[model samples]
Target chain A: MKPEYDLLVVGGGPGGALAARTAAEQGLSVCLVEKRPAIGVPVRCAEGVGRDLLTEFMDPDPAWISAEVERAVLVAPDGYRITLEPSMAGCEVGYVLDRKRFDRDLVMQAANAGADIQVKTRAVAPIVKNGAVAGALLEQQGSVSEVLARVVVAADGVESKFARWAGLETAVPLSEIETCVQFLMTGIEIDPGATVFYLGNEVAPEGYVWIFPKGDRTANVGIGISGKKCRSGSRPIDYLNRFIKSSFPEGRVLEWVMGGVPVCRPLERTVADGLIVVGDAARVSDPITGGGIYNAMFTGRLAGKIAAEAIGRGDVSADGLMPYDAGWRSSKLGMALERNYRVKEYFITLSDEKLNRLVHSVSQIDLAQFSVLGIITELVRQDPSLLLELRAIRKLL
Target chain B: MLLIRRDICGYCGCCVSVCPQGALELIDAYLSVGEDCTGCGICARACPLGALEVADEA
Candidate 1:
């Protein structure tokens, strides 16, 4: 007899693992599945997280942190550099994770929490029964089996089909999706405590290039470009190759990663009958930064807790899962996403001249009392009409 | 009317999801462009790596 699970979480990333662990901790029987033989292989992220936010959720494990960033460097098209020293209270990032270890540790936590983990097991499709998701048909090692669950949590990343399979509108417009490529390069002389960003259309064509240092001599050098802005038949790899040739000619590429990020507003509906989508599957990433780990964990934690409660009450319908959606959107994480998306949409269309001007203006701002309002004020000083537009954004946010 | 940069395609299946006509499929890690494609350019536009394009073959 196939063992029935009260909660089944798919993907095994931070969101899925955390959700499974959270539910199991609440005394719910949970099963977590990962298609990969191990988690976090062939890492696709640049892997930087705000220190304060990371610590707020869980204790920072020594094994997971590769480097601690203290400064941020932004270079404009003309090679004008703007250095920022983010205060402890601000949204400055502090850690660049060793992604492999970080992801494995999360899965380990889930396993320790008593969730049945099945690595190398793929969830082929949701088994809908009686008009709601009953379980999923899973395939592993040439064998197929059914794992029934009262609720299914889809924590799959941006490329997930589970949400759509469960009858949700998960389509992302071209303009809102970022095609990304990353190379873990070694032998580069870079500050391990500084995160670098190169911004310009010529640099990434509607996106930016980043170098998040993992250690003194190695970093994750990457580019993320808007899908629609790409020229006909040109790959991000072409741009990345050119950037590498110019910037880090001596850097040795250790690994190559290719993926897409959906940088849009959270889906209007993350919950359907007996199913809830969290993380990138729900487009919970920050549109401006394309960072989803924090939001994923936030939504996952809440979804697991809420799902456990719903199952306890014997109501696992869409209505029962609505509270998870409401709780996540009402938190600070939701507020940041809402505001960032507005800012990103407003600024993404800026021309090269305007972008250079903006970068130049940002360089001139004093960091002694850095704040969003102060930066906006400085930007308005450079381009007076921006004051009015920014005011509109403020109102919307 | 569809141009695929076969060498550049990363086989991410992002295009498969955006194809309105269901003309794209990832078979064994390879992109299989079907005859049902209408040259709507949605797949080309949605491909993150810019691996697809619409050619003026008409």
Candidate 2:
């Protein structure tokens, strides 16, 4: 029997939804399968994203934005602070999203574009025939059914098994993964127009604590620590609770969320014969920030468009899908992720004293604007020895 | 019944997502197997850390 769908997208997050919508727009028969009863619930992200990154794919929808940030407040271990006007010099602070609405709208777009969306449906395993993925065995409501497709797009977030099942090495090293946990709290005093980042090993070990305001008196406070650096046996939640008690003792408890973040380069291999992996499954999140939504949607749209084109040409093999990999790497999103990973590697090696000094120096510099290059220049000026470090790091890369 | 390997559990909560019965909860960063568990073994299969295993009930 012929395949039931031209594209079967597993996991209906930003990536899968966009992939399904894009494929359907291209006139391909698309099916989007999500394990949850709804697309976005039990929200797991910190939800801070730059406006430019978001506008690249879709317009600014008011239904999804929770708060507008004007600046980024960076705090050091010893309480030193450096505040940067994010929107100036193109380093925009952007907005924290209401992910439930944001995610649901994206999936709705896919559905409106003519993709069949199945919720509470889990893809148990990929169906392989003649050494290539043909579809998946789906389990929904205690019943199992095999859904056939010409191509499969895996966007199953951090614990994706589709890529692994398709013979790709998606295993992220402990050093490259971030164990993140967050709490949405009320009764907190926040700038409402600024996001706070607390640094220093004492605060969160190799990770950092963030306060992204949702409103005048509410925020999503969280921490993300490197898995390898979590040696104290204290969970991220414990660290967060400690930080909260000290910072916002009167804050009311609300909700708790936990998830793993892949803080590495995009997967070395995201495409296999008749299979394509996008978003978190492909490890497209930023190594330093652990932000994946924008990149997920970008890569998803690219994958869907490429899948449609490849299907039209009747070549669904690995060679045919190589363009998706090449396209992602060549995009601005891909370039930024690679650069950030290197920056993160270098930053993690600095001592707390050095970090405090670096921030202090930048705070003193009367720069009229803020940009990544501007910050790097300030760091280099504060310590000329970093030039040698940068050169060595470049050679290693 | 479900068993969790405490030493290996990073408590990332992937198993909680795949549980059809909502039988798993991460309390204080540990998997707390609840009464709703039907020994479906789905959590064990979905755990990224390989920290969960299922056994026959006595």
Q: Pick by DockQ: which candidate is best? A: 1
- Residue A93 CA error for candidate 2 (Å)? 3.5
Model 1, DockQ value?
A: 0.38
Q: lDDT (0-100) at residue A214 of candidate 2? A: 92
- What CAPRI grade goes to candidate 1? acceptable
Chain A TM-scores, candidates in order: 0.96, 0.96
lDDT of 2 by residue, A1-397 (tens): 1238999999898999999999999999999998777789768799999988898788988889999888898898889887777535655759899999999999999999999999888887799989889899888889889998999999988767677767887666666667777889999988899999998887876778999999879999999877666533465666888899999999996877678777878888788989999998899998888889998999999999999999999998989999999999988888888888888888788779877876787665546635554566677777888888767445433
How do the residues A108-195 of candidate 1 rate in per-residue lDDT, one tens digit apiece? 8888999989888878789999889988988898888999999999987776767777888786787788888889999998888899
List candidate 1 stretches off by more than 4 Å.
A86-91, A366-374, B1-13, B16-41, B48-58
**Residue A29 lDDT (model 2):** 94
lDDT of each model, Cα atoms only? 0.82, 0.82
